[model samples]
Target: MGRNTRKRSKTTGGKVMAAAAALTLGAGGLVVVNVYASAHESSGGNAVKRSSQGSSQGGTGQAAASEASTIDCPDVGNGLRQVPDQARAEVDKQLALLDTQISEAYQRLRSSTRALQQDGNFANNAIMGPLKDKRVATIDRIATAMGRAGDRPQGLESLAACTLRASGNQSDTGGNQSDTGDDQNGGQAGNGPVAADFVDITTVQPNVTAPRMSQEASRGTFATQCGVNENKLYNSDNVIVAPGVDNGAHHTHDYIGNQANDAFASNDDFAAGETSCQNQGDKSSYYWPVLRLQDGTEEFDAQQQGGGAEGNTGRILTASEVTLEYVGNPGGKVVAMPKFLRIITGDAKAFTNGTANANAAWSCTGFEDRQLTDKYPVCPEGSSLVRTSKFQSCWDGQNIDSANHRSHVAFADPATGACPGGFKAIPQLVQRLVYDVDAPSLNDNGRSSPFYAVDGFPEQMHKPITDHGDFVNVFDEQLMNEMVQCINTGRQCQ
Candidate 1:
């Protein structure tokens, strides 16, 4: 199925609910609307209350009274299913520009508190109007490039207009907002990760289940020992998504496995790069956004573009343990993944794009059975925080990547554990990261104890739901065959 055809489905109030809406720009220009559904209901326990405060890092503290508001634009990248190879580069550049535009507009919204309070129409008149004009021109360039190479994408102009949306923190809040006196939200930039973003793991019921294995199941697993990013390799460039764009991710990523990965790294660079894995033949690149503690300390990227300057501040916390394992499909034997196969498991913009592509799984060490997708888990004293990502296990067996960077691979069926027709099952990379950090004290909005959040785009508000991971397969032919053989024979190999 196409990426745009999929809808986010969640089980709430004992019934599965799927809500989706889209906006089209008319002759009048931009139409302001809320495109996402309400926040997921807390399974149990009383709702947490939140308050707005100025960010110590110079945020203007101008969110709406009830919830933090941000600019929401239709994701143009998600709708582009096809772009000719000749136009791919230009399309990617345009997509990156689109992201940059959104980030810039969001920054304006966050900084204009006085204007927002003084003039009710300030956001629509100043921010949204200019943003739509820029987007229309950028999108036109993309369409022209694609038309010159292949077919022009239709209905792209409809995506140019943007609107203001309250970040999905409505249902999660209850009682009265608390004033912590200290002027800071969980995030140093005051953009997000408020008290409502976290929930005690113990209060959440067990929600994970195992898929049934068939007789043809390839039950073996292959584990790669890539150290926990001990070398401290980090960057904001995304080679797979925006190959030639700097700060394409708008957030720093902690890299392991492959040593030579950045926005400028080509396929050849990845092939010739050094490996951090114990097995020299396995040079795959694995990276995820760095998690940061919202303490007052400034890190190396404090003054950098994709770091503190972009609202991703705080001390970067290296994962205590990083486990990269490839497991087989439950329905049948798995095939070797193609070289340079790029897979992004979660959605970094799930906060605005909705959860159709969200795959973040958070839990405590002992409470692994209870995974929290929307809320950050507050682990007890002895327990460590965990972030788990299970990558797409089925490949289309043709392209190494797609225009949207997601169409080439797909997750197995939730119930049947089978690959879609015409696609082959591949060994799925299951990454588990363990972090040792103190739980944030939610009552005072993490004032006494700082909140820890995964790095994301500034406008994404450091939402836990936006947590994502990326991987590029660079295993040598020998190691790749060995892994496939080990899996088919039902033997665990490393």
Candidate 2:
């Protein structure tokens, strides 16, 4: 909640947007013809899958670390919902295909939606009726599935991403438009990243609103963005769109699929926060800010093509970044904003550089992003990005270690009888802070910490410091132990 950083003003029905985010899928080959008008809400999209459709290798979901142990959300279930690795692998393959298809469809709908909205001739009554009908029909199908998900609620990403597939069946708004032609013409319907489908996100849903300033700010107000993952219920995904936005604000998040734009070979594999379009001008980092308007739709705002980026990537920086007060969702679940995971990394230049370091590395690629997160987004160039650990004033290894020593307790190894050295167990109190409130958690949705999960999760983690949210309660020993138990024994998880 840095007041100085968040200068933008936004007022939405008096709801304060803490650190919220939204998401938008790349358009291509996706065909979501029906639009629903029901207010019946569901949670999250399907689990992210990897594709095998293209000649390209399956976009590896996060790489599995044999050394890494999955934190059993014991409260979530008695290991009943956990899918076996083999089954999980198959899911990844299917997800990859779905991602590709959706990417294509995303491009298509984006165009159609924009045309219907921007084209003065296209009236809401004429276009929106069919759209609403389709939306309603689709929502019914989605609602039925949600009803079937049973009492064990699924992750918001999974529920939101219902399995909707399209075989590039619909006619693109810009008929016969291909990638090369769109690029040569520039700003044509297909000029943006071509989706398997047609249109950009804005056109289809004309009234779609991104996240805005909290009313809290307007009274000459103040605010906070992502907290220390304290509140489990709120985050970008948990948002319930207003009653009028998407046909009475249908809550069933309908999704087609996804694609891996990870063009960098040195890419650490695809992760959501970074840009895929190779910067032509050659800069260190691409600023892609995932934003959400009041309506609850998501979109990508990236570095200026003027700064060597591409497409609306340049036009997007209008708000750039802004922190807000608690939007209700303490940290994860239903954040008021659109998307999660703010930046790709602290080091701008070497995101692809430390590809040489096998011990621990950061990645921008979708597949590689999985395992690297445990170590966090460090690059060979170190922390050069602003407002991150890499910043000049930020602590070095020694200082960081010292801070941990002062604030944290020794991590006791379960297998061994001794406590960890130079390492501290993430006090259960702090687990939510590190897991839910940190930068990665703040800006990410879909899969858990697709990154982050590394070697010493429950037993030892980074000390709560600058990176942790402000809600860290030093005196809350009981709360801390609760968190510690959650970390060590996976207790009281829901």
Candidate 1 structure quality by residue, lDDT tens digits, 208-294: 899898999999999999899898898888888777788899999999999888887767778888999999999999999999998
Please report, in order, the local distance difference test score of every candidate based on alpha carbons.
Answer: 0.77, 0.20
Q: Of the candidates shown, which would achieve the greatest lDDT relative to the real structure? A: 1
Q: Taking the tens digit of each residue's C-alpha lDDT, what string does model 2 give over 1-494?
A: 00011111111111011121222111221112121111111112212322222112111111111011111110111111222322222222222232223223333333343343333223122322233344334333422333343222233232122212211122223345343233212221222111221111112212213334333211111122222212111111101111111111101111100111111111122122222112211111111121111121122312211111122221111222222221111111111111111111111111111121112222322222222311233212221111111111111112111110111222233233222455322221111111121212222211111112111111111101102111111112343233333333323321
TM-score of each model, in listed order: 0.86, 0.21
- Superposed Cα RMSD, model 2: 23.6
**What TM-score number comes out for model 2?**
0.21
Task: Report the lDDT of model 2 for residue 91.
Answer: 25
lDDT of 1 at 21: 35
